[model samples]
Target: MRKFDAIVIGSGQGGVPLAKKLAKAGWQTAIVEKRWIGGTCINDGCTPTKSMIACGAAAHVIANSQEWGITVSDFKVDLEKIVQRKNKVVESFRGGATKGMEKTEGLSIIYGEAVFTGEKTLNVILKDGGEEAITAPHIFINTGTLPKIPPVPGLDTIKYLTNTSIMELTKLPSHLVIMGSGYIGLEFGQLFRRLGSQVTIIDRGKQLLKHEDEDVAAAVKKVMETSGVTMHTGANVQKVEQIGDTIRLQFTANGENLTITGSHLLVAIGRTPQSTSLQPEKAGLALDDKGYFKVNDQLETNVSGIYVLGDVKGGPEFTHISYNDYLVLYKRLVNKEDTSIKDRPVPYCMFTDPQLGRIGLTEKAAKEAGYDVKVACLDMTRVARAIETGNTQGFMKAVINANDDKLLGVAILGPEGGEVMSVMQMAMLGGITAKQLREMIFAHPLYSESINNLFMTLEK
Candidate 1:
């Protein structure tokens, strides 16, 4: 049995930095990870996926080189090389995380699965067939989440790929059938399509990105469709089975039952929090209906001195948000500052070709929240930078408070959309109004300069 000042379970985005901070504060911290060092962001989620997306983006550029007046005779996607490159990036990040923990004083990295044995105690099943009991006055859970596999008939009979498993592919599938049209599906669908795979996406929703504004969703769909990705909305997947070398997926859309055959089936429905294995019942911690650790605004669980952070605690499951969790907890716990997660503008980006960067509320959400909202929309074709790059495929939209001209939300779905959205995020953070933004002098011929035009469309 060993005792520490604090025990951090799961070396995830929040847990890693939190542990280091705690240890640096002279607290004896033990951070336990069952597998990997930097959690899902570095191991499988953001790091590896973005690396592959970058490769796919390069492939897209090379395939369309003739548009740039460059002629390329032949090109091929080496899946082996792509996977190797992604693995290298993952390793670099993971190694850096491990080294950081090692050098930090009062911090010990434990390799094992940790389960709550008592309110302030953990029993770790070591990776190498050993066990240890550790106790601490404070415990932080950041186990994160895993890809959720839907229960379709005959689905488990054949091997299917989840977001994590699909990354291990060293060979491109001839035809890839994705089971959802959400962010994960859209990203990988376009990725493999750019990599020369015939991609098909099926979704139960009537429209892609159902939560997004209709026009924004339509624009994203149009961009993806123009890029040669097939989408079947309003699709209800019924069954899946393997026939010879192909996987057959049976689904119905618009009263018509159909079967689609693909060399690979990717079940990208959603993710489930990694709470089941922790045995939270032992610690008497209650979970939400969706199985996430229920936490207060300060990210404290029902149990005092026990906290939950990142995806396991639910809400927006972005890496940046998870990282912010560390900041919130650190400020509240270490600096003794008063902070809460409420009323924070959450921003996220989808890594499609023309990235979809979104912040704050959508127009629909703002309207639903009873705000007198005014929307300003500008096509990418109108943006000088988009016109110069010839990558004008999406639009920029901003939702403003009609009474105060304050930006409620902004969505940019064009070249460098994520970067442009970050600027708006900062402006919103600083309480910049739409009129002020429109009058602001921005650098010419840059994607961000479109912000001026975006707000110019707003009625006074």
Candidate 2:
């Protein structure tokens, strides 16, 4: 049996940093990881996906360069080379994080699967085919999540890909069929299409981004459709079967049965927390109805000396949110500051061409919350920068408190929209009002300058 001052389960953004902080604070700590050092974000999720997206973006730029009066030909996508490049990027990031964790004093990283045996005791099934017992007064869980695969008939009999496995393909699919039209499905759909694959996306919802406002969702759907990816919204997938190098998917939409054949099928529906292995019941830890760890505003579990963080604790599952979870816990545990996760601003960006960056409430959400709101909207085609670049495809919408003129929320769906949305995120944090932004001086012809024109809609 071994003991430590603290134990962190999972080497995710939150666990890695929290373990490092505790070790640096002169407390002995151990981080138990079932796989590689870095969590899903660096190892497979964000890093690899975004790297491939960049490759696709480059292809898109060259293919469309004719609009700038530049004639080009003989363009080709080296998918194997693209996968190598993505692997290199993931390797660089994961290597750096591993080195930092290895060098942290007073910290030991155990490569094993940990299962709780009691409130504060656990056994680790080490990678080397051995078991070790360990306990700690404090335990932090950042296990993140596992890919949520739907239980459709014949799904188990055929070889299918999840978001993680799909990235490992060295050759482009002749036709790729994707499930779920949310951020993950959309991003991958556009990426594969840009890489020269015949892409098709199926979703049960009528709109692509089901949670966003209808207008916003429609605009995104239009952009995706224009990119040559087929969208089958409001469809129910019945089963999938693969026969002799071709995969067939059958579904129903509007009472009509439909079938799709593709070289590959990607199941990107969603993710669920990895809890059954932890055996939280042994620790008396509480979980929500969705199997996520039940955490309070402070990120604490029902049991004392135990806390949860990152995607496993559920909320918005962005890499930034998981990193912020570490900060929130560090402030209270290390700096002894009174910080919380309650009502903190969440800003996320979909990495589509003409990215969708969003912060705060949507117009419908604002109205539902009983706040009198004023909406400001502007099409990207009217923005000088977007028009000059010839990549105008979407729009921006902002919701403001009509009574006080304060900013409530913003959604930007245009080129480099995430960067532009950060500008609004700062404004919301600083309490900058819509009228103030309208009158502010911004550099001419910048995407951000469009903010001025966006707010000007309220006056007209």
Candidate 3:
């Protein structure tokens, strides 16, 4: 049996960091990955999505060049080249991550499917038809999630794509039908639409981004509608079938029978945890009522020397949250710290055109949590910098606690909205009050000045 001080399953964000820490801390460590290195964010999800979005943004700029008095000629999307470039990016990072661990002290990288053999033992099935036994004092379950595909009739028989498969397409679909209105669907819908595809989004929720405040979602829906995204909220997709080189989607929305046809269907419903395959029960690990690993405040699982974090633990599923998990788990593992992955203002961003960013509680969430909430909202069209940029669309909403003058939450749905929300995240993380943020110096005619102006409207 090969023995190590620690073994980490999955080479995603959490496993990468924990493996590095264990090796750096003078402990023998090993990371076993069932697939490629660098995990989902690097290999598929974040990197490729952002690359394609960049192409969309470029298309938008060229399309609007006439507004800037620049004469432009034929601008077309070379999807094949874009896919190649994105693959190059992923390959570069995968190489770097693999190399980073190659020389790490007392660290071994295993490429295999690891299963629980005993409480502290693992049976690894390598791709090369080789079996190996490994034992470690501690095991970290960092196996990330897969795209959640709902049970839609005829969904399997048809060629449908998820975030994983969409980026690999050699050609853009003439028309794309997205199957959710969540961040993934909205982002990809906007991206492909900007790149010249007729995009339609169908969601079961009454509004896109149902997790956000209604006003914020409404503003986004308005902008998206203006940008030509056909959104069908409260819509249920009944089936998808192949119809003469096209895909026909059938659904019911608002008591109406609807059939939408497109060249491709992209399913962006959500992601599901990959825990069941690990058989955590064999290791005395219990999953929550949801499929995620049941983790405590210290990020520890029910089994001693085993822990869980990130998406598998069922919190915000941003790449940054996984990094934060590394910090919390690192402290607990190295210094024996008393810290748990507690309350911090976790910011989430949707990379739609102009983008959308939010941190801390939503207006409804704060009020529902029994706090006296004061709101300040303003349209970006009225903001000086937004007007200057000539892309004035969407709005900013700030939710403040009335009794304590503290910043409860801030949501922005406009140009540079993602960049603008970092200050709010810092404020909530550092316990900065709303009054203080309002008083902070912001340069004139800047997009961020909207933050100050929005706070100025806060009423007691």
Candidate 4:
């Protein structure tokens, strides 16, 4: 039996930083990791995928260089090199995190899977055919989610690519079929399509992004469909089978049977925060209906000393949100301050060719929340920078409070849309009015300059 002042399960975004803080604060800490360090963002989800997405973006630029009056031809995409570059970037990030952990004093990293044996006690199954029993008065669970696979007929018999495994492929698929049309589906759908794959997406929902406003979702669908990607909305996937070298997928649309074949298939419906390993019941931790830990504003679970963090808590599963969880916990525990997860701004972006940056409420959400809303919209075709650069696609939208004229929500779907959305996010944080934005002087011929025009539509 071993004892430590604290134990952190899973070296994720939340656990790694919190573990380091506790050790630096003179608490002997041990962090257990089932896989690699630095969690999903470094190892699988964000870093490697974004690296590959950048490669796709480069290809897209060359393919459309004629619009810029530059003739580009005879281009060959080296699949091996693309995968190599992504791997190099991921390793660089992981190595830095590993080195930081090694340098921290009074901190131990155990390579194992841990579960609660009792309240504040853990039994870890070590990697080397060994076991260890460890206990601490305070324990943190950062066990994040895994990609979920749906139970379609014959799906188990044939191997299919996951978001993680798809990135490792050195050869491009002739045709790629994906199930689920959310962010993961659309991003990867455009990514491989730009890299010269025939891409098709199937979704059970009637729309690509059900959470977005109808107009915004329509624009996204148009952008993807206009780029030659096929979208089958309201699809019911019946089965999957591999015949010869080709993978076959069957679905029904509009009460009609349909079949499609592709060289690769990706099942990206959603992610599930599985409690199979952690055994939260052993700790008397209360979980919601969806299996996420029921955390209070301070991020504590039903068990007083055991706190839950990251995707396992289940509100917004973002890398930045996970890091914020670490901050909230640190301030409450170390600084003795009243920090919480209540009403923190959540900002997210979809890395398509024309990026989509979203913050705060949607127009539908604002109206549903009983706000008298004024909406401002500007198409990219109307923006000078977009017209001059020849990448004129997508639009920008802002929902304002009709009474106070303060910004309620914003959706930017154009080049560097995320950057423009960040400016608006600051506006919201500072309680800046729509009138203020219109009168504000922004550098001319910039994408963000459209903010002024956008509000001018509403005020004028």
Query: What would the per-residue lDDT of candidate 2 be over residues 1-460, giving only the tens digit for each residue?
Result: 7999999999988889899999999889999999998899998789999999999999988888888998788699999999999999999999999999999999999999999999999999999889999999989999999889899888899889988899999889999999989888999999999999999999999877987999999999999999999999999999899879999999998788999999999998999899878999999999989999998999999999898889999899988999899999888988999989999999999999879999999999999999999999999988999999898999999999999999899999999999999999999999999989999999998999999999999997
Give candidate 1's TM-score.
0.99
Q: Report the candidate with higher TM-score, 2 versus 3.
A: 2
lDDT of each model, Cα atoms only? 0.93, 0.93, 0.87, 0.92
Order of the predicted models by lDDT, top scorer first:
2, 1, 4, 3
> What TM-score fits each model?
0.99, 0.99, 0.97, 0.98
Question: Which tens-of-lDDT digit does each residue in 1-460 have in candidate 3?
Answer: 9989999898888788789988899989999999998888898888778988888888888988998788798787899998888888888888999998887878899999998877889899997789999998888888888999999999989899999898888888999999998888988888888888899999999977877888888888987787788999999999889998999999999999999999999999999998988777778788888799988888888888887767888878888888788888888778888777777558888888788988889999999999998888888877989888788888888888889888888898889898888877887778788778788898887788777778777643
Q: Would you list the clashing residue pairs of candidate 2?
A: none
lDDT of 4 by residue, 108-128 (tens): 999988988899899999988
Error of 2 at 174 (Å): 0.4
**Candidate 1 off by > 4 Å:** none
Candidate with better lDDT, 2 vs 4: 2
The C-alpha local distance difference test score for the whole of candidate 1 amounts to 0.93
Compute the lDDT for candidate 3: 0.87
TM-score computed on alpha carbons, candidate 3: 0.97
